[model samples]
Target: GKQITHNLKSRASEFIFYALALDESTDMAGTAQLAIFIKGVDVHKIKKKTETLAALYPLKDTTKLQDLLEAVT
Candidate 1:
C-alpha cells in the first residue's frame, strides 16, 4: 500500500488533456452569445472555465461534464 501510494503521488502531477467547444450567436450587445472552443485542453483550463461559466451562466452543481456533454450533443 505504501509503495502504491508513493507511486500515485509521483504521478499526481501528470499532464492531462480535455476539450471544450461552445458555439453561440448574439446581436446588439458585444457580449451576447459566446462560443468556446477547447481542444486538447487541460485540467487548469477546465476549472477556470467552469467557475466562469457557473458565475456567468449559472449551471447547477457547478460541474463541467454536463456542459461538455451538451456541446457534444
Candidate 2:
C-alpha cells in the first residue's frame, strides 16, 4: 500500500499528454469507449510549468475535440 500510495503521489503533479480515441465497442452495445494514452517526462520541474500555463489560461471546452487535438499537435 505504501508503494502504491507513493507512486500515485509522485505522479500527481506530472504533466501528461493524452492521445484519446473514441469509438463504439464491438459488442453491439450502443455505448462508446474512450481510450487514453499518456506520455511525458517524469520530472517535477515540468509540473511547475504546467501550473503556470494553467493559471494563465485555463482549459475550456469551446472547440470540437478534433480541432483541439489538431491545435495541440
Candidate 3:
C-alpha cells in the first residue's frame, strides 16, 4: 500500500494537468463513503494515468456536499 501511494505521488508530481473524480455512496449499514480518483497526463512522456487517491468514510451520517468536503479536507 505504501509502495502504491509512493508510485501515485511520484506520477502525480509529474502531471501536466489533472482532473478528479468523486463518488459518494451508502453501504448496507447506511454509512456514507466517498471515493476519489485522479486522472492526468504526464509532462515528460505525455502518458495518461488514472489512480484511486482515497476512499473516505465520513463520520457524519449523510453524504451531502458539506459532508464530503469535510471528509476530504
- Model number with the top TM-score: 3
lDDT of 2 at 32: 28
lDDT of 3 by residue, 24-62 (tens): 877788777776677787687676564556444444777
Clashing pairs in 1: 20-38, 22-35, 22-36
Each candidate's clash count: 3, 0, 0
How close to the true structure is residue 55 of candidate 1, measured as C-alpha lDDT? Answer: 12
lDDT of 3: 0.66
Predictions in order: lDDT? 0.37, 0.34, 0.66
lDDT of 1 by residue, 1-67 (tens): 3443343333333325533345454445443333443344234554432211211222223235665
Q: Which of candidates 1 and 2 reaches a greater lDDT? A: 1
Root-mean-square deviation of candidate 3: 4.7
Please, what are the lDDT tens digits per residue for candidate 2 over residues 1-73?
3443353345444655322222222224433222223344445555532221111111233345653443333
Candidate 3, number of clashes? 0
- Pairs clashing in candidate 3? none
